[model samples]
Every structure is written in structure tokens, then in C-alpha cells.
Target chain A: MNHQKREDLVKSVLFVFSITASLILLLIIIFLFNEAIRLFQEVSFLDFLFGTKWNPEQGLYGAFPFVFFSIMATLGALIIAIPLGVSCAVFLAEIAPGWARDATRPVIELLAGIPSIIYGLFGLVIIVRFIKVSLELATGETILAGSIILAAMILPIIISISQDSIESVPKSFKLGSLAMGATNWQTLRKIILPTALPGIFAGIILGVGRAMGETMAVVLVLGNSENMPEVVKQLLGKEGSSTVMQLINQVPEILFKPGEALTSAILLEMGPAQVGGLHYSALFALGVILFCITFVLSVASNYILSRSQISVR
Target chain B: MINSKTSDKVMKGVFWFSALLIISILFLILGYVFVEGIRVVNLSFISDMPKNNWREGGIYPAIVGTFYLVAVALLFAVPLGVLTAIYLVEFRKEDNLTSIIRISVDSLNAVPSIVFGLFGLSLFFYYLKDFTGGPTIFSGGLTLGFMILPTVIRTAEVALRTVPLSEKLGSYALGATKLQTISRIVIPSSIPGIITGVILGFGRAAGETAPIIFMVALNPTMPEFPYLFSQCNALTTQIYYLTSEAISIERAFGMAFVLISIILISNYSARLINKYLARNIRR
Candidate 1:
């Protein structure tokens, strides 16, 4: 073929491919909206949002407890991961010598590359066992186990992004602080931290997204219980035999130890669920919520990063 | 002000504590997996079919399936991802349209795999189910191809962007056309970056379980060959299957170790290749 013809053909082909990629995202939104709307027809939108119950078998299907459980696990992970991650980033950027930087940096990068399934395995086998014995609680599985595992999973993203942000801070500021006889800590706190705030925040937000949307690892550990909030409260206070408590008691201890296995419900139960049933719909709704929150977080991160870039320029 | 001695002590404590935590976590996890998995990672473990005995049998089907699916994804993704990146970087003018494309790529990367799972299951499997007869490698591959396209495009674009503007100018100065300059000069200069991006995609495609799990429920035993449209096994699928069997834990760990090894090898190779090409380009 002539060069002109060839070039046109290639360009058109490439355009079609990229369009397919773009179209897939649109399809996801459309499909989710359709399925989620179907769900709304069955359950009130407000009930799905604010209702505490989530027993699909009984036709009580509120999503508040799962939302709370997800938020707590994610927030708890951030609380543990950020301080450690930021501190490590500080060490890498300002304190590590050149040789150490070269060796240590890749190690941190490797952490990011480890698949989520592997993380799930480690949590399931090792972390869960360790926690089960260490806590000595009736239910070895707790939200705390998921938080700790997720914190480790997100640690690298936080550190790597934060290090880049910290390094990008103008050297002049550090030099000026040093000239004024400020200690390294003083320079880091007064000069580096403030300037790098935007990038650091961007990194933390990305880490949050990772934690929030995490599937396999959280699924493996979070004891998958489907308790309404009021039921949990009532169970907590009275020794009386409520129906919810009786049902929960009938379930295996291993299955419900984490008190509520909210995260893994999608991956674990999807395989066996009767198609077009409430369980399946609920999982799809969960997927929809997870997608929206993570998408918003990523967009916000890019915005912050761009703002920081403009500021630097 | 805190005394120098106290400051030094504090810094040392903080650095050591943080460093130790990170190093310990990495080593502990790796060590645990290796110790448990290595016991069952023999040849029999790799070659045997998914028998009732999960502990002694191999993960042959999963390995085959995983590689097949990834190969299919790359077949579709590499050309398309690289080409779109070239168009966006070279041919298209900086306009609102291009900005939309850029934003879309970023958003694409951020979408969760499960959402991609649902979309892939619906659009490719459900809509196109008639063509393939059912969920097969074609559907799974298309889904993963869409999922990994953003990573490939973004990485390739960055690689293309890193090529000096002067090089483009030099090609134009020699009266070369846009296509010639891109293919001859820019691509050669950016080959490392492009390959690195491909490698990155490979790592992702290999490890993905959620998106494909629902779509590709192939037969467990080895299916007949030349069956492009048939269901198949993969490493992640095997891991999932093994997780359920009471004794499959050891084999699952071994399979996981293999998967992790493959990912690390791909990533390390990418970094190495990128560095090599970059060094040559500068010279």
C-alpha cells in the first residue's frame, strides 16, 4: 500500500481502538445506572441510603451498615498508613543518603506492584491468625484486621507519591532555612511540609481510594455478617433472643467473626447467587457505590496535583 | 530549641523505626508465602490437573488460562493503546477535544476493576454472546483489553512526550513527514517507554481475578486445542478454585507465589529495559 493509504488506515484503526476504551467507561456507568435503577424500583432510594437493615433473604435491604463499615475500614487504614507513610517519605527524600535512596526506592515501588489478591492471601493466612490469637477476643475477625491489612497495602502509594512531592519542593527554601541556622527538622516542618502539602494530600487521597475500593484482601478477612445497625445495638445490650441474634448465632463462628463481612460480599457470594435476585442486585449496588466514590477521589486527586503543578510553575 | 543530641536521637529513632516496619512487613509476607508455598511447588504441583487432592495436584490449567487470556489482551491492546497515544501526542492539536480525551484516560485508570467486571460481563459477554456462543477468551480478553488500555496509553504517551521536541524539529527540518518522523525517530527514542508500558499492562493482566472470574468459567480439565472460542483455565482462576478446597491452601499459595514472581520479573525487566533504551537514546 502507498504510504498515505497506510498512514490513514493505521490512524483510523488506532482511533477505533481508543474509542472502544473510552466507550467501555461509558458502558460501565450506563449498565450500573440501569441495574441500580432497577434496584430502586424494588427498594426506596432513601431506604437504600439511610436504612440500617441489609437482610436480603428477609426483604429488608438498607445499606447504611455496609457504608459505615466500609468508611470505618478505609478511614482506619488512612489513620494508620499516613503517619507511617509520610514519615518514611520524609526519610527517603531528605534523610536517606544517595546509595540508600537508589536501593530503597525500588523496594517501595515493588510494594505498589504486588497484586491485591496476594495481599488478601497474606491477610487471610498470616495477619488473621496473628490477630485472632493476639486479640484473644471471641470473634478473631474484626474490622481492625481489615484496617491493618489495608494500611500495609496502601503504604507504598502514600510514601512514593509523598516522596516525589517532598522532593519537588524548591531547594532554595531548604537552603534559606539552613542559612538561618534552622535544624533539618525545622526546615522539614516549616519549609518542606507546607510547600509539599498539595502533593502529599494528593497521595493520601489516592491511598484512601485504594483502601476504600479494595476487594480481595478486605473480603478475605472482614467477617461477613449482614447486621442492621439497630440489631447490632440491640444485640450488644440485651441477652434476649432477638430474631436477628438467633439467625446470627445459627451461622458458623468462622463466617461471622469479623462481625460484618461487608467487603467480600461481592466477590464471595456472586458465584452462587441466583441471577436477577436481591443478593445479586445488592452486590451490583455495592459495586456502583464503590465505583462512584473511587472515581470522584481520583478526579479530585488529579485536580489537586494539577493545582500543585501550576503553583510550582 | 531541642539540643543536637536529642534531635539526633529522635531522628535516628524515627528513621530506624519506620524503616524496620517497612522491611519487616515485606520480608515477613514474602517469607511466609515462600515457606508455605515452596513445600508444594514441585513439578507434580505444576503439571497435575485439578484433582480432588488439592494439596498434591498441579495448577496446570490455571497457568495455561492465565497466559492465554493475557496474550489475547495484549494482542488487542498493544497496537490500539500505542496508536491512540501517538495520535493524541503528535497529530492532534491541543484543544478541548484533546483535553476531554486526557480526562477520560485518567478517569479510566481510576475506575475499579469490579465495575469493569460488570461492564465487561454485560457489553462484551452478554451483547456479543451470540458470536462466541458464550463467555470465552474473546469476551474475557476484550474486557481486560479495555481495562488495561488506559495504563498502556498513558505510559506510552508519557514516553512519547519525553522525546525531545528538537528531535521532532530535526525530522521536520529534513523534510520528513509527521508519520515518518514518529515511526523512525520518536518511536525509536521512546521504544523503552512503550515497552515498559506494555510490560506494566502485562503485570496487571496477569494478576486480575475479579473482572475475569465472572466472565470466563471455563471447564476445569484441559479443553481441546484449536478451541479459541472455548472456556479455559488461568492461574488466578486456579487460585480461586483452590481457595475453596480444604487442602488446596498449599497449592494456592504456591500458585500465588508463581503469580507474584511473574509480576516482579515483568516489572523489573521493564525498568531495566527503560533504563537501557534511555541510556542509548542519550548517546
Candidate 2:
């Protein structure tokens, strides 16, 4: 009886620690939104979401171009990463010999373990220099530089998740396809990819979440601007003397401007901006937006995971 | 059938190409860091201090700082995390409170580390200032402790859940109490998994630059014994500073090399422990 009572007490204390941890997450969301909602009162939601100018110094609090840049950089990274990541997963899950899989698995794991700061440094030295010479540009920190580093950083996550899904396809399914006269490659391409589509899609969404939340590394290479990319504007045939056109030209003369994305904007503003200022609140507002987007994406992926018949989770 | 054969060949080529690309990217990153970093990372460089406004000398201080930071983080986090796991696994009643806690933990796991930085800045700097003081090693460690809580709890829970029910039943059958069964059997069995989480979490905390950026201050005066309230420099943040400023490219590379080695060794050790654990379980 005495021992049982002591056990219950110790267990209750442990329970409190665990509950406190979860409570902190709820507190973070409420606090971030609490700070962020201040910005909404200062600037209408439409202007904050769609207005083009982001000269917070001039009290122009538009953040749409930063949003556009973040999306473009993330999409650019995905364009490079998806093919490489998905293919690598397919190879590891279905094609690689056991020895080969063991050898390569550690290498990819090591790649993932390499810190983001190191990647930023590598991009700054070799990639930035390479891009400058190859593209004939004055400076190399651009959307492209950020995208390359991000793609590398996100590749491991994509490969690991995608591979899990591919391997989880029941052995009977593979044998069935082969017995029906399909080749190994045909079975993988026709049956396996389709079956694992939801998992792969989840992996991609998670990768996007990673790329979007990334700050320190992207900040190092992307010049941290609030303007649109010239390459994008040029491709759009955007040449005129209108306000938007002038804004595009105002961006430094380069194929890709040294630009800031949304996260970088927050990082840059967080340090120097005075506490409790509108600028400070706006940065927090940016954090709130990011938190919401990632939260939704994560919850959506969880839904997909639950909905799927296969237990990728 | 002929068309299908041709498509198979094409798809096979694509898969092989992707595997090749991943290997090459790995080699490129490793090779570049090693070649560039090896030139500056001599014994003296590792053992010395930053001299001449950080243009010369070694990175001894940053190494020490990272050790204390990681140690303090583990010291605070490991106990809380392990306790939480024990509660969830051993004492959970499956009621609404328990389910809500589980969901919140899952959602917490999904929150990005940078958001933790923001909250850390606000909580430690703005709100919890009375206890945390301001921008100290303790505050940074606390912030990181929060950041890594989900990792520790989830891994510990997994390790606990893996313990067989028969072992507990056997202990009870022998007249040992529930506490004795847990302390003797369940915990001993779970130690390896908990250690794995600690090491991985340590590696992550050591490498993390975002979470502590605002919560920790720069100690320009050099590394004396770190106090809870004193500032310190870490390997990752120092690399970021050194690279951006280009103050000393060689030192930045050297630091990068060391930081990479720290994480690599941690990962390799985790793999070894996991293998050893797996073999023991089979027996």
C-alpha cells in the first residue's frame, strides 16, 4: 500500500512535466498571434497581403513581393529537388543491392546531419563564386543560390520519407505485378508509384515546409531584398514606365537581385527593430503568417497520412 | 509489349541517374569542406584563441562554449523528457486530458525551431526575465531544452512502448512491486533508446544556430567559466558570423570543419549504439 502510493505520486509529477511541454506549444501560438494581430490593426489585411511596397521605414508595410519571392524560391528548389529526391527513393527502396543500400544510407544521413550554417558557408564560397563567373554577374547572392542550397538541405528528408512509402508497398503487390509479366521497372513505375503517391505528396509538402521556414542559410545567400526578381519580370515582358515597372527597374541591375524572402525579413527586422514598435510587430506578424502556413501544411499531411490505407506514419 | 519494354528502359535510366546525382552531391559537399578546411585546422588552430580581432589564432573558446551549451541543454531537457515519457507510457489513463496532451505534443513536434527562437526571445528576454535574467547561457539552454523536448519525449515513449508486457507480468508474479519492475526492468531496457535520443538531440542542439541567436549574447571578453547569466559563443553561430563578415575565411572554414566532425561523430556513434542495442534485443 505504501509503495503503491509513492509510485502514484512520482507518476503524477512526470505527467505534469509532459503536460507543461504541450501547454508551451499552445502558449506559443497564442503569444505569436497576440503580437501579430497588432499589425493587422495598423495596416488593413488586404494591404498587408497584396500591396507591393515593403518600405517599412517609410511606413509602407506591404509584404506581397516578399511573399512572391519566398514562393518562387521554394518552387525553384522543388523543381530541382523532386526529380532527384523521388528517383533516389525509388532506387533505394526497390533497386539497390543490400550492400549498396547500407553504404549509401549513411552518406545521405551524414548529409542531412550537416548543419545549415555549414551549407550557407559552402554556398557563399563555391556556389556564389561559380554563379558569378558562369552567369557574368556582379554578385552571386540571388534566388538561385538560395534555391540550390535549400534543395540540397531538403533532399534527405524527401528521400527518406519517399523511400519509406515505396518500401511499405506490400511484397505481394510487387510479386503480383511481376507474375503478370511486368518487368521490375514496369512494376515500380506503373503500380508502386501510384500506390505511394499520397506518401510522396506528403513528403513534398513537408519538404516545402522545411524550405519555407528556413532562414539563416537562405539569408546568407539571398541578399535579403524585398523586390521581385528581374528574370521573372523580364520573362513576364514587364517593361514600361508604370509604377510597377519602375519598381522592377529600381531593383539593382542583375539577372537575379540579392533579395530577401519572408523569413529573412523577419530575422533582419527582429534584431534591430525597437521592442513594441510597429516594425517589430510587423515582423512578429510575419512569424504568425509563417506559423499558420506551416501548421496548416503539417495538419493537412497528417490528414493525408490518416486517410491513406498504408501506415506510412 | 515492345513499347512497355522501351518505357522500362527509360524509367530504369532515370532512377539510376537520380541515385548517381545524390552520391555526387554528397561527395561534392564533403570533398569541398575537407579540402578547403584542412589547410587551416592545425593542432595550434584548434588549441589556440582568437587573436588580433579574430583575424588570427584558434577556436578553443567556441569549442568550449558549444560543449557547455549542449551540456546545459541536456542537463535540463533529458530529465523532463524522460519523466514525461514515463508518465505517458506508464500512467496514461486514455482519457480526454491524455489525448489532448498527446495531440499537442504532436503539434509541438511540428513547430519549426525558429518559431521556438521567437518564443524564446519573448519568453526569456521579455517575460521570464526575472528568472532567466537576460541573454544568458541558462536562457539559451532553456530555450533549446524546449526546442528538443518533443524529440526526447517521443523517442523515450517509443523505447518504453517496445518493452514487452511479459517482463512486467513476470516481475509482478515474483512479488516485486510496480515501481521495482519499472526501475529495474523497463528503465534498464529503455536506457539505450534514451541515450540515442540524448546523443541525437545533443548533436542537433550543438549545430542549431537559429534557436539561440536572440536568446544568447556574444561574449567578447573570452570564455571564462560559463555562468547561467553570462554570454557565450557557439561553433555554428561563430561560423555564420565568420563567413558573413569574411573577417577570417580560413578560421571560418576551420570552424566549419570541426563543427562537421562533431555532428558526423555523433551520428556514427548513434548508429553503433543502435546496432549494439538491436543485437542485444535479438539475443
Candidate 3:
């Protein structure tokens, strides 16, 4: 073929393949919406959002409890993962010896690369068992366990991004602070932390997105309970536990159960989830919620990073 | 001076503490899995068929099945991804069309894996199941191929972009056709980048549990090698199943350890391939 023909053919091929990617995304949204339409038709939007109860058999649909629990667990995970992940990044970028940094970074990256299922398995065998034996819990699955594992899962994302952010702060900031008689800690605390906050937050937001949508790991550990929020309150009192415990208490049990019709529809119902069931639509709805949350978080992070770049300039 | 020293100690402490935390976590996980997984991960474990007794079950089928699925998935994904990247990096100008492609790729990467499974279930299962007669490895692979396409495009594009423009100009000066320049000069230079992207995508595909769970639902008891169309078990699915089994926590840990080790090895191999390509380029 002539050069013009070859270029045109290549362009056409590339365009088609690129369009495949877009078409796949479009297909997912359309399919989910089509299947979930039946769910909306049957259940009131308000009930799905605000009603206190969730029973598929009776056709009651309230997602408030699941949403609340998902938020609490994810927020709790962020609380733990962000600080530790940032500190790890700080150490890797700022203070670690060359040998240590080289040795540790791969291990962390490997940790990041390992599939969440392995984490889920690890959590199930270790964390859940430990929780059951020590805490006298009804079940091994709890919000605390989910949060802890999630914190671990998101740690690498947070650390790597924050390390980049810290590394990007320009050496002059560190040198300038030291030149001004500020100690390393003071410099890090006063200047580095502030300068790096935007990137760090971006990383944290990424991690948050990971935590919120994290399925296999959380599903494996969170015990699949689908209780109402008030019942969760009662469970918290009986558990009589720490702040983490109370938070765990607040997580509705139904969302964690296999058959319950609330949160975690994706992980729980992948195969055996009845066709066109409320469970399936709820899962799609959860996907919509998850997509929106992650999208917002990503936008915020990008905005923050861009603003910080401007400030530094 | 006192304050400076105090802050130094504090910062150092935090750093060390964080490092220690991460290291210990890795150690703990690896240690636990190794301790449990090794007990059942012998020749028998690899050779035996799925038996009612979880204790004596083998994973030969799963290992082979995983490779087959990944290979087929790659066949579907790599060409398209490489082509897309070539266009984006080599030919396409920065316009609305290009920007749209870039944004879509980014969004693809962020879409959760479970969502991919749902998409696969509906598109491949509901719409096209008649073509394949319900779930087959081909359908699952097609779905996963689409799932990993964005990663391939992004990574490959970056890899191709990293090729120096001078090479392209030199090819043109040599009276080489544009196609010749791309195939001979640009791709050769960006071999490392392409390999890196492929490696990363392969790693994710190898370990992905959510996307293929529904697509390849109900693990086959024994894998048919000659019949690649036959349903088979994969390492990810095996790990998921074992974890969920009431009596197989030990097996689950063992499988998890194996999966993690395989991922690490693949990554190292990919890195080695990149280095080798880079070395040859210099020569």
C-alpha cells in the first residue's frame, strides 16, 4: 500500500480501538442502568436513600445504613492510613538511608501490586480470627477489621504519591529551611508539611477512593451483616467498646451479609446474585455512588495539586 | 539548638516508626502465608485434581488455566493497545479527539474492577451469551482484555513518547517511509516502555478477581488444555474460593502466598526484560 493509504489505515485502526475503550465504558453504564431501572420502578428513590429498613423479601429498600457504614469505615481507614503513609513517604524521600530506601520501596510497591483478594485472604485468616478470639465478637467481620485492612491496601497508594509530592517540593525548600537555622523536624513540620499537603491530600484522596470501593478485602472481613442503623447502635452498646468499636457497632450488619440487600452488592453477588434482582440493581447503584465519589475526590486532588503548584511558583 | 535537635529526633522517630510499620506488615503477611501455604504446596498440591477433601486438593488446573486465560486476554488487548498508543504518540495531534481519548483512558483506569465484571456479565453474558453458549473463558478474557486495554494504551503511549524525536527525523532523512520509521525506529526505541506497560497490565490481569468472577463463574473441575474453550479455574478464582471455604483457611493463605510470589517474580522478570532491551538499545 502507498504511504497515504497505510497512514489512513493505521489511523482508522487506532480510532476504532480507542473507541472500543469508550464503548466498553458506555456499555457498562447503559447495562447497569437498564437492569437497575426495574429496581427504581419497584422501590421509591426516597426509600432507597432514607428509609431505615432494608428487606428484599418485603420489597423495602433503604441504602442509608449501608452508605453510613461505608463512609464510617472508609473515613476511619483514611484516618489511620494517611498519617502512616505520609510518614513512610517522608522517611523514604527525606530521611531514610539509601540502602533502606532501596530495600523498602520495592517491598512497599510489591505490597501495592498484590491483589486485594490476597489482602482479603490475609485479613480473613489473621485479622478476623484475631478479632474473634480476642474481642469475643459475634463474628470476625467488623468495620474495624475492614478499616485496618483497607488502611493497609491504600497505604502504598498514599505513600508513593506523597513521596512524589515530597520529592517534588524542590531541594531548595529543605536547604533554605536548614540555612535559616530551622531543625529538620521544624522544617518538615513548618514548611515541608504545608508545601506537600496538596500532593499528600491528593494521594490520600486516591487512597480514600480505593478504600470506599474496596470490595474483595472488605467483603471477606466485614461479615456481610445488614442490620438497620438503630440496631447497629444497640449492637455497639452490647459490644461496649472503644471509639473504633462504637464505629464498628454503627455499621449495619445487613450490608455485610451475603444475601442482604444493601451495600457490597458487587462483591457478594457477582455470580450467584439472582438475575434482575434488587441485589443486582443495588450493586449498580452502589457503582454509581462509588464512581461519583471517586470522580469528585480525583477532581479535588488535581485542583489542590494545581493550586499548590501555583503557590510555589 | 535544643529545639532543632528535638525536632530532628521526632522526625527521625516518625520516619523509622513508619518504615518499621510497613516492613513488619509485609513480614507478617509473608510469614503467615508461607507458614501455612507451605504445608500443602508440594508436588501433590500442584498435581492433584479437585477432590471433595480440601486437604488433598491440587492446583494444576488453576495454574494452567490462569496462564491460558492471561495469554488469550493479552492477544485481544495488546494489539489494540499498542496501536492506540502509536497513534496517540506518533501521529495524532493534540486536539479534541486526542484529548477525548486521553480522558477516556484515565477514566478507564479508575473504573473499579467489579464494575468491569458487571459490564462483562451484561455485554458478554446477557447480550452475547448465545454466541458462546453462556460463560466461557473467551468471554471472560474478552471482558478482561477490555478492562486492561486502557492501561496498555497509556503505558505504551508513554513508552513510545519517550523515544527521541531525533530518531524519527533521522529515519525521514534516510528516505524511510513513515511506516518504516515507526516500525523500525520508533517502536525499537520504545521497546522498554512497551514491555513495561505490558508487564504491568499482565500483573493486574493475572491477579484480577472481580472482573472475571462473574464472567467465568463456576470453576471447572478439570481443565482441558487442547480445548482452550473449556471453562477452567484460575489462581485468582482459586484464592477467592479457598478463602470463602469454611474449612480452607490454611489453603487460602497458601494460595495467597503463591499468588503474591508469582506477582513479584513476574514484576522482576518484566523489569529484567526492560533492562535487557535498554542494554541492547545502547549497544
Candidate 4:
């Protein structure tokens, strides 16, 4: 009876400790919302979400620019990363020999472990300079620089997860395709990739979440400008050219212009904003927006990942 | 048939090119930093204090501060994480409460590091200012603790799950209690994995700059011996400051090198531990 009581006590204690993660998460949501809700009282929700300007000093609190930049940078990064990451994943999963896979996996893990700040530094010293000198831009801290850095930062996640998913397509699938006299590439493209699509999609969504939330590297290389990218204005203005030609000329300009992201705005302004003031609340509100976006993405990815795991099992 | 063969050849080339591209990028970053920063990494640079407005001298204080913050973070995280992993692996049933805990862990892991910084500033700096000394190492460390908690829990849980059920059965056959089997048999077998988790968590905490920038790290100062209740510098924040302010490029590279070295070493050692454990388990 005494031993049984002790066992029950230990189990209960462990149970309490296990709930610490839940409790901490609860506190985070409560505190973030509590602080963020105060801003909606001052700024209308629609205005905060859709307003174009973000001057906190004049109390404009327009967050659209940062949101736009976040999306733009994430899209740009995806454009660069998806092909590279997926192809690398395919290579490692389907083509690499045992020793090559073993060697390459650790290198990728090391790349993932490198601090984001170092990536920021590398972007500043190498990428930004290269851009400035080669393109003769006023400043090298363009959305392109940020995207490049982010692409590298997010590559490991995409590659590793996609690789796992691709590899998990049962050997029988490949064998069956081969038995049908399909080419290796055809086997992969038709059988393996389609089966792994959900998992790969989950990885991509997680990568999007990562790109959206990345702060330090973006802060360094994004130039943190509040103005809309010049290309957007040019395209919108439709200045003195055929629409198709104007778009072709202006599309590349988008990558070269300085921009601010939601994460960068928070990191840059949190210091200057007065405590418990509107600016401070607005920053927290930005956090709230970021939190909501990443939370939804993560939950969606998790759901997809779990479903895929179940299907595989 | 010719078309199919050509397409396969082209796709194969593309795949190899992509893989090579990634490997080259990694080498380029590492090699550039190593070459630019190797000159400034002698013993004195590691031991002395900054002399001229952070343009000259060493990064001793920042190094110490990084270790201190990671130590404090691990102090909070390891116990909570290991215990939580223990509960999940050994005691959890397929129930709502367990599901809730699992979801919370995943959600917490998904929360951005910057958001955690904001949350820390609000909770520790504004609300619990008196207790946390309003953005001290204690507050920053705790914030990081929360940020890396999920990582620790997940890795430790993986390790704990790998311990064979037959080992526990044998313990029970000897009339051992569940607690005894856990403490003596399960934990002993999983120590290497648990240590790997702690080391990986340490690497993460040490590398993180966003969560601590506002909460704890301030302008570089000689970190006092017992500076838990005071603001201090960190290697990561130092790199951020150096590059952002254009204070000293060489020093920034040097700090980046040191920081990368620490992170890479921890990561490699964790892999080594995992490999060793796998071998032992197979045996």
C-alpha cells in the first residue's frame, strides 16, 4: 500500500511538471493578447491590418507595408528555395550513395546550427556589398538580400523534412514503377513525389512560417524602409508604357528596393517605443499579428504532418 | 524513348547541381568568416576587455555573458524538459490532457523568437520588474528557457522512447517499483540522449539573439561575477551590435567565428553522442 502510494505521488508530480509547457504557452497567449488588445482600442482593426503607412510617432499605425514586405520576402525566398531545397532533397533521398548521404546530412545539420546573426553578418559583408557594387543601387540592403539570407536559413528545414518524406515512400512503389519499365526520374516524379506531396507541402508551410518569423537576419539586410517598393508604385502608376512591358521592366526592381518586415519593425522599434504607450502597444500588436500568422501555419503543418504519418504507418 | 532518356539526364544534372550549390554556399560562408576572422582569435582577444568604444580589444565579457545566459537558461529548461519528457513517454495515456500538452509544446515551438522577446519584455520588464530587475540576465535567461523548452522536451522524449520495454519488464520481474525502474534503468540507458538534448538546447540558447536583445543584453560591459540581476552583453547580441552599428567589422567577424565555433562544436558533439549511443544500443 505504501509503495503504491509512492508510485501515485510520483506520477502526479510528473504530471504537474508536464503541464509546465501548456501553462507557459497559456501565459504567453494571455500576455500577448492582453497587451495587443489595448492597441485595437486606439487603432481600428481594419486600419491596423490594411493601412499603408506605419509611422508610430504621428500615430498612423498602418501595418500594411510591413505585412506586404513580409509576404514579398517570403515569396521571393520560396522562389529561390523551393527548387533548390526540393531538388537537394530528391538527390539525397533517391540518388546519393550511402557515404555521400551520411556526409551530406551532417553538413546540412551544421548549416542549420549556424547562428542567424552570422548569416546576417555574411549578408551584410558579402551579399549586400556584392549587390551594391554590381547593381549600383543606392543601398544594398534590398528585399533580395533578405530573401537570399532567408533562403539559406530555411533550406535545411525544407531539405531535411522533404527528404524524409521522399525517402518514406515505400520501396515497393519504386520497384513497381521500375517493373513497369519506367525511367528512374519518371518513377520519382510519378510515384514517389505524388505520394510524398502532403509531407512536402507541410514542410513548405513550415518553411513559410520560419521565413515569416525570422528577425535578426532580415533586420540587418532588409534596410528597414517603411516605403513601398518602388516597383509596386511604378506598376500601380502604370507610367508611360505598355502594361506588359512596364511589368517586365519593373518586376526586377522589386527585389532591389529596401523594405521592412513585421519582425524587423518590431525589433527596430521596440526600443524607442515608450512603455505602456500606443507605440509600444502597436508593436505588441505586430507581435500579435505575427503570432496569429505563424500559429495558423504551424497548426496546419502539424495537422498535415500527422495525417501523412498516419497514412504512412 | 529518346525524349524520356534526355529528360532524365537533364533532371539528374539539375539535382546534382542543386546539391552542389547548397554545399558550396555552406563552404563559402564558413570559409569567408574563418579567413577574415582568424587573425583576431588569440588568447588575449578571448581574455581581455574592449578598449576603444568596442572597436578594439577583446570580447571576454561577451563570451562570459553568453555562457552565463545559456547556463541560466539550461538551469530552468533541463529539469522542466526532462521531467515533461518522462511524463509523456512513461506516464502519458491517450487522453485529452496529454493531447493538449502535446499541442501546447508544438505551438510553443512554433512561436517566433522575437515574439518570445516581446512576451518577455511585457512579463518580466513591465509586470515583474522588481523581481527580474527589469531586463536582467535572469529575465533573458528565463525567456530563452521558454523558447528552447520544446526542443529539449522533444529530443529528450525521443531518447526516452528508445529505451526498450523489455528492460523495464526485467526490472519489474526483479520486484522493482516503477519509480526505481525509471530512475535506475530507463534514465541510465537514456543519459547519453538526454545529454545530447541538453547540449543542443545549449547551442540554441547561446546562438539566440532576438529573445534577449531587449530583455537582457545591453551595451557591452564587463560582466560582473554575480550579474544575474543585471544587464550584460552576449556574443550573439555583440555580433548584431557590431554589424548593425558599423562599429567594427573585424570584431564582428571575429565574434561570429567564435559563436559559430561554439555552436558547431556542440552540434557535432551531440551527433557523436547519438552515434555512440546507437552503437551501444545495437550491441
Q: Which stretches of model 4 miss by more than 4 angstroms?
A: A230-249, B275-283
For B96-196, candidate 1 gives per-residue lDDT tens digits of 87777777787888777767777676666656678865578777877788789898999999999999999899988999877899889989898999999
User: What digit string (tens of lDDT, one per residue) describes model 2 on residues B6-78?
Assistant: 8888887888788878888888887888888899998987888778756688787788778877888898789
Worst 10 residues of 3 chain A by lDDT: A254-263
TM-score on alpha carbons, each prediction? 0.91, 0.91, 0.90, 0.96
Interface RMSD of each: 2.2, 1.9, 2.0, 1.0
lDDT: worst 10-residue window of model 3 chain B:
B217-226
Q: Who wins the lDDT comparison?
A: 4
**What tens-digit string does per-residue lDDT give for candidate 2 at A1-313?**
5997998887777777878777788889877877778789989988887767778788888777777777767887898999999999998998888987887788788777788888888888888888889988888988889888899988998899889888878888889999999988879878899889888888888888888888778878887777755544544455433465665564434326677878888877787788878888788777877787777777776666556644533
Q: Is candidate 3 or candidate 4 better by lDDT?
A: 4
True contacts kept of each: 0.42, 0.59, 0.58, 0.80
| Model 2 regions lying over 4 Å from their true place | A1-3, A229-255, A309-313, B93-99, B219-226, B276-283
Model 1, residue pairs in steric clash: A223-A261, A224-A261, A225-A261, B45-B58, B62-B234, B62-B235, B65-B233, B66-B234
Error of 2 at B29 (Å): 1.2
Which runs in model 1 stand beyond 4 Å of their true positions?
A1-16, A228-263, B223-226, B276-283
